[model samples]
Target: MGDKVVKFEPITHVIFDMDGLLLDTEKVYESIIKKIASKYGKEYTLEVRSELTGRTQVDSAKIAVEKMKLPITIDEYLEQYHPLCREFLQTPDLMPGAEKLVRHLAKHNIPIAIATSGNEWLSKIKTQNHVNLFSEFHHTVYGSSDPEVVNGKPAPDIYLICASRFPDNPSPDKVLVFEDAPNGVEGAYSAGMQVVMIPAPEVEEELKRHATLVLTTMEDFVPETFGLPPYDE
Candidate 1:
C-alpha cells in the first residue's frame, strides 16, 4: 500500500518574518515613527503602528500622510525617520525564545529564510550586526525595494518570493512561518505555509484567526508536538 499523506504535514523549511516576529523591535520602531511625525506637528499614535505593521515604508508614509494630514512629503518623512532607524540599530533585543527557536530549527538542518518589509540596508542592520542572533540562522534574506510593489503584508508577495528563493527546496507547503502580527500571519497563510504566531499583548486576540498555531513564546515550539523531527543536524 502507498504511504498515507497526513492531513497536517510536517514542516521541513522555516521562513521567518522579521520585525515583530523575531525581535522585540516594534515598540522602538513605533517610537521612532512618532518622533518623526511629531517634527511635522502630526500626532502619531499606537493605533498607527498597528496600521503600519508589515507595510513598506512608502506605503506606510502614504497612510501617515493621508490619515494624519501631515504637512511633509514622503521624502521628507523618510529623511526624518531613516536616520532614526539607523540609530535604533545600536541596540537590539531578541524576542522571547527567538534565538533558541532559530537555533533549534537550524540545528535540525531545516532551511531558514527571512522575508521582511524593511529596506535592504535597514534589514541588514537588524539581521547582521545589530542583534547577532538572526545572522547565525538565516540562510537567505529578502526585503522589498519599496513596500507598495508586493502589497506588503496582508498579501503573500514577500513570503512567496522567499519561498521561490530556496534553490534546493522551493515547495511552499514544506515551510513553517513564524509571525507576530495579523498582516504577517495572513501573508504566510496566503503563501500556503503553516503559520505560528507569537504576538504581543496588544494584538493577541486579533491575530488568532490568521495563525495556524498561537503561543505566547517560542519556547512552546516543540518539534514533536507538530510532527517535526528533533534537531538532528
Candidate 2:
C-alpha cells in the first residue's frame, strides 16, 4: 500500500521563542551562567542548562541557584547576572534564517508574536542590535514579567495569552509555535498548538519528541508542511 500522507492542522497565527530560536543570545547566556557557576566553584552542566532553558527569569534563577547549591539568594544571582547579560545581549545577532522566515511570514500576512520568558527590560536589551527584525512581531508577551502571564512556559499561560492578544484572537489550535527548548514545546502542546522545535546541537533526542516537528535550524523549516505559506524564490 502507498504510504498515507500525514496531514497537519492549518496554522493561522504564529508564535516565536526568542532566546535561542530567533536570536543567538543563548550562548551569551550560557557563558554568563558558566562564569557565575565557576565563581561559586561549580560547573554549569548541560543538564542544568536544559532545566533552566525556557523558564521565566525568576524561575530560572531559582532553579539554577538550587540546582547548583549556590550560596546566594535568587535576587543576588539576578543582580550579578543581569549586568553581565545586559553587556552582551545588546549586540546579539539573529539566528540563521530567522530574518528570512520572519520576513516571509510578514509578507504573507501571517499574524506573528513573540512569547519570550525574558522580562520586558531584558527583551529590549537583547533586541537592541536588531530593532527592525524585532519590530516585525505583531506583539510580544514577556512571560517573566508581563502582568498578564500568571505562569511561565510549561504551564501554557504565555502561549494562551499570546494567541488571545492577536487581533483576530486566534484559537489555540490555530497557532503554530517555533521553539528551541523542550519546555517551550511542552507549553505550546499544553496550549493545544502545534510546535516546531529547532533545538541546539547539544539538546538530547529524547527531549525533542514533544514537538510536532524537530529541525536542526530554522533553515530546515518547511512552512508548507504545516499549512503555512511557502517561501517564494
Candidate 3:
C-alpha cells in the first residue's frame, strides 16, 4: 500500500509534552533505568524503553519490574529510582530549539500549554533549571498526579484536559500537540489534534508514522507550515 499523506491544518492552540520533548532528560531516564535493570541482570533495551515512555511513574515502574523480572517491588523501585532521578532532573538542559520555539510562540500571543506524564513534583524538579522557559506556557497539566487526568499518554484525557484549561477552550482539532514519544503521538491523535513528533534517533520509523509531521529535532519545525507566525530570522 502507498504511504498515507498527512495533512496540516491551521492550529489555534498548542500543547507540549515535557520530558524528552522539552528537556534533554530522556538520556538520564535511560541511564537510570539501565542502571536499575543491571542489578537484576536484565538488559534495558530500547524496545522496552519505548514502551515505558509517556507512561506514569508508577505505571512505568510496574512495567519494568514485570518485564525485567526484577526482584523488587514497585515501591522499592521508586525508592531507588526517585532519588537518582531527582539528582539529574534538577538541572536538565532544554532540548534543542525548545526555548526559542516556546518564547516565539509566547511573543506571538499563541496560546500554549504543557501536557506531561510526569507528575507535579517530578515536573517541578525537572524544570527547576529552566523556570523562565516553562513559565511561558499558559498552563501545565501533569497527568500522573492530576485529579482531572484519569489516564496518561496513549489516552486522550491529558490532552483534552489541557485544551479545556486554555482561556478559549479551543476544540481538539484546533490544538496542535508537540511530542517526542510514539505514545504521545497516539494520544494527541486520539484526541483529534494534529501532532508534530520530534522523536529520538533510536525510535523506530514505524512508530513515527502516526504523527501529522515528524522531525529530527524541534529546530527543524516550521511554524509557518502549521499556520503559526514565522520565526524572526
Tell me each candidate's RMSD, in Å, in order.
5.1, 2.3, 1.2
Give candidate 1's total backbone clashes: 0
lDDT of 1 by residue, 64-99 (tens): 877788888988878887898898865567777778
lDDT of 1 at 169: 60
Tell me the whole-model lDDT of each prediction, alpha carbons only: 0.75, 0.91, 0.91
TM-scores of the models, in the order given: 0.86, 0.96, 0.97
Clashing residue pairs in candidate 2 (N, C-alpha, C atoms within 3 angstroms): none
User: What does candidate 3's lDDT look like per residue over 1-233, in tens digits?
Assistant: 16777679999999999989999999999999999999889999877899999988888998899888899999999999999888877888889999999999999999999999988988988888788888899899998899988888899899999999998899999999999999899999999999999998889888987799888899999999889999999
- Clashing pairs for predicted structure model 3, backbone only: none
Candidate with maximal lDDT = 3
Compared with the true structure, the alpha-carbon lDDT of candidate 2 equals: 0.91
TM-score winner between 2 and 3, please give it.
3
